[model samples]
Target: MEFGFARHMFVGALMCGAAAPALAQEANASGAATAASRADGGGIPDIVVTAQRRSQSLLSVPLAISALSDETLATKGISNSAALATAVPNLQVSSPYGSTQPNFSLRGISVANEFNANQASPVGVYIDDVYIAARTSHGMGLFDLDRVEVLRGPQGTLFGRNTTGGAINFITKGPKLKGTEGYLEAGYGNFDTFKVQGAVETTMVEDELGIRIAGNYEKGDGQFRNVAPGGRDPGGVDTWQGRASLRIRPGNGPLDIKIRAYAGQNRGTEAGIHGLEPFRTGLGFFEVNESRVGENQTDAWGVAANISLELSDAVTLTSITSYDGGKQNLQQSSDGAPIDVLNINWRSTFRQFSEEARLNYESDKLKLVGGVFYGWDRIVTDNSFYIGSVLAPGVDGGFFQHYRQTRRSYAAFLQGDYNLTDKLILTLGARYTADRGRYDDGYAYLFARSVTDPQTPIATTVPCAGAPGSCAYDPAAIFNLKGRNNALTGRVALSYTFDNGLLAYASYNRGYRSGAFNGGSYTSSSGINYVDPERVNAYELGLKGRALNNRMTFSAAGFYYDYTNQQVQDLRAGPVNILVNAPKAEVYGGEVEASLRIISALTLNASAGYLHARYKELALQGVNLAGNDLPFAPHWTAQAGIDWKIIDAGSDTVTFSPTINYFSRQYFSPFNSENAPGTGQINSELQQAGYAKVNASLIWVHDNLQLRGWINNAFNRKVYAYGLDLRGAGFPYNFLVPSTPRTYGVTARVSF
Candidate 1:
């Protein structure tokens, strides 16, 4: 059957549906009255998510769900999902292009390179049932969202075929009727940042059809100072987005359909994170006139459709199918510094295609779910150039090259839980997938050709670009290789619910990440050397509960991961680039979360996490990198916040919140044998210092009119977290990517 909308009735059938808020249960004085065995929103809606590729409640799924409410997002300075990783437990995010593009990871299992959009992210990010495909795909996806759910664990059950580590799903707001409502917000902050966003929704046919549309635009200056010739000045990132959606519910039937379309673009500087020098057991000292490099321009868009139908009193059938895709072409200079220094330049472009189709049937006794998924990605060109011989900086040698990779994947799964009794439940799921991909590498250079004298030859050099012995003039050189791999994955879970709203569960799951050949120096030739996919077997225990009559909720989980034949970055004997598969490894971590409402208008929330990710064993042709700390993995993180309101307000309500976030120190450059001397890694910085950030915001609401102001990183602390230097020309301390600094802005919003 065609899972996508039917040709003849798709549009018409969708315009006849109605949205009804969740049917709330009656409550008693002690707060028990607020317990929601189900959601309390418009229409008796089902929480549809591929958490395990099934439609289930946000509370009962044995796994952990770190959900951020739409109401909460607006109150805080959180404007995008990428900024959420650090706020969520055990979840971490990193970006190359800018803060807008984030690569997500859970319990510290992130894939090293995301240059290939179609390849897989250790953690999958999806929107409205459609899998996002470009490396730069969902960077601007934070606007006009309903809620965001971050699911942590090896999701081998049901989802996009390539979710090996975890998954994040962004659910947008649907059509709401009975009231013509929408809001417009405009603000100006640090770096001369200017932003505007607005939305509107009204009933077109009373209780039958409804439509809503929203749009946003944000621009700011380059934050860092780049004084180099051909180098861009700091503080320049501009972005914007637009979205439209429609809802239809058939009369006298348990059916509803929602369709949405969205588009966004980004154009700015792509400053690679700056690197740092080892502390050398000394105090902090500084330098003047540092800069960053490169320029980036991107465009992305997609569409999604969801259909829900109740077949009977005990069964409901839901189908969600969507086609989503995008592309990004970016050029950047890596580690160039000290204004006017001719340095290394790199360029990359990616295009991706993804699709997912699933069928879900739910009943009081048991839930049956199954689905099929596939995705394709092509990283057509990845080029990096060095202005001089890398090791011997003064030698006049230059080289440029490109690498191409294509990753294709397919998967099938069956999952659900069967209730044995009112308090006991059994959950199980299985998945199998076939994955294949290839890597192509090549490079060309312009430099002095070196040779040994024919007799007692001291090294002699010519200016020929070809024939290895002459420098008079010649051009180019190439290298090649090929690789292929396939694998199967699965998961199982069990949980028990108490008389109260508390649940406990245990699960064992599998995760897989496809591997690829290395293109060190960006010049290796084409090869199928797509290394074998890495696999993980995880064991976990979790607890989920609702207290104070559902006014307060708490959830926690801990897990241990065992990996076989792990795929990791390996520096070759000569520092030339390449990736390899290791024999085995063990990684572990845990996360905790809690949310509570102290009073009708006051609430408190906090989350803390810890992870110990290391290489259990490593070998490069038999030499070992065992016990090495995994790069970029932080050991500890915490986030907490509180909300307060002013009462006795006539038609006017005021709310304020202050938040704190922290991350422990993490290593960026390898300090172990996993990376020996010659590989480009040796000179790389050792570790990125951990730091804390504090932010607060104020909001006033007065019927159709709202005002908000915020200041982030209030102390103006300079973070060494993402030091990126385009002006230092191999200078130390480059991982210098800056979080917004003491930014403050006010926005006026109106709704009609």
Candidate 2:
């Protein structure tokens, strides 16, 4: 797939110059207005968002964004972060681990294969305006959310560093100074799955103080059937989370404060791997033969405070402070075979603290926002790999790696919007960021053991002094590494609003991501190399408006990216994965989203995306990767859905929703190797073919009580969430992580 610059420019020009008048004319038509009013009573409802650091209508925002409210989330079955891709155009989420540690890709920009605990993702994740430094913690606080906003393209101006792909903001519901309210929900599903969730809110003082508490718990029997003797299933779910929030108005003054605390834990098995080679056990699909069952044990907690003080009618000051920490003890069988080929054990702890302060000024013709931010994070990992057992019987060979990494970031940003005329607006913004990263206490060791007695090591080699054979030591690797980066990023945009309420915008933005040391080094000291930071220059044209007198809402955008020094994880270079930077690349994409209320009781929504991402210059291990497609970037993606209110009574209503999502064929590696480089045979496992999934739900509501029956992946499609090529490591098999199978459940809820 290829998209040229000439076509992009031509389309942009058309959107900017010709489309406005046509849209305005259509909106002014009397028949359209009458039809819209008769279709949905008042047309589509407006959603207020904070994409620009201020409250505004979603259609009024000049950027490409997709927002999902709490009601939408529940009806769509977006219970976790990975499911978000189904609703948003040009967005993809993947992880080596299932349902957790999600790595987001926006507009074909992403961290392709890096899974080290110390490395941060290029796609920034935020909770109530606080950045989450740890990737493993991104899955938390997904429950009881007010809305989730996905900002596409470069968010450098306001979001600051490490947001080259984009950003996801999860805003939770806060306590309201009103009457007492609460809700309780419970569900049961296949595989013996059980779930319970609830929330309670109360006003401690009339219009002065309010508090809210929420919790969720879920457990289930695993989906993957372990066929090996005495082997347990590995895809089960056992997790629980709790949160408490307090809001203060302080005598109904201008000072507003919100304090929130949350905690969660996951005690379940890891995702089962599926091998693609013939040498492994001949098991059926969704069946794994493994000697050791992996475990997924994690604990996370955080606290945050947001304070806002109104200085006057046109000026306000806001401060946000947060601290978060988590720990994980994970074990996985990498080869997916009954034989002990490769097993990994990881023990890690992470913590982060952040503070941000901003001031906003709004007037008739001008608006300004400025902020200063500081963040610090640290991660300590003790990881071990058990290898060489499959090739050589009666001998167990393994290696241990220990490292501690700390990072500090400081940034200052300012943005201003001025109305050039009654219908024209111009926006300018910039941010200066400085980052420091230190990798210390890094060392590794080699050990050998007899298979008969795996508990004791027969031979051990330690590389650092004071480090015993049992692998306990500090910063004595061969060298300690420190990286520093300073960058200036910004955005400029021009927008026009037509008389018929149509918005057209064009923008240019620059985005930057910090550099860091390779945390995946385990074989030798030379493997711990530093990768340079990446930068992107993006240009975009977009249009957002409501048509048919508000019964139809639509948004369209086209974007092009000039990317340099793109960071990637190269697994074919050696036995261990290495971080490297691709010198140059180009990406272009376009997306369209629309929703139409066909009638008062029926609505239709659909979205489609097209992407062209390719490397312009890259050569690794004598293989030229130029003109190859980037990993995890599909050329085409689309989704369609319908919401129909089939029945309505005096106080009772029933609705049915059905959706389908489609994805084109996509490569998992940059090589895109069809014949395994010089072998004329077919390597069909390198890519996933085009696929589609179907989901449906039926909901009934009666006053304060509700019931829902839902089914996901109704056809039980065979799909892989992640894949890795082990051929470079002298293995004939490739590792593939399969997605969840068909699931059906029924839920009931009561609200007071």
Candidate 2 regions with alpha-carbon error over 4 angstroms = 1-24, 28-40, 276-282, 390-393, 450-478, 571-576, 674-684
Give candidate 1's TM-score. 0.82
- Residues 1-752, candidate 2, lDDT per residue (tens digit)? 22342234334433433453465457654323433343346578877899999999888899999999988888887887889988887788777778767778888888865677787788889989888888888866367899999999978888735578899999988898887998999999998999999999999897889999999999998888888888879788899999999999999899999999999988878887876354345676778887677888888899999999999999999999999999888888877877777788888999999999999999999999999999999999888778756425676777777788999999999999999998899999999999999988777776675322353433232333322343443334345789899989999999998776778999999999899788887755556777888899999998887766567777888899999888877654335556889999999988877777878789988777888999999875457889988878888777778989999887899999999887777777777764445323233576777788898999999999999999999999998887776666556577788888989999999999
Candidate 1, 137-254: lDDT as tens digits: 7566466777888888777777675566777888887786455778777888777888998888876766667899989898877665544444565436688888898888766358
lDDT of 1 at 313: 63
Residue 589's lDDT in candidate 1: 71
Q: Which residue pairs show backbone clashes in model 2? A: 441-475
For residue 740, give model 2's deviation from the true position in Å.
0.7
What lDDT does each candidate get? 0.61, 0.81
The candidate 2 region of ten consecutive residues with least summed lDDT is 459-468
Q: What is the TM-score of each candidate against the true structure?
A: 0.82, 0.93
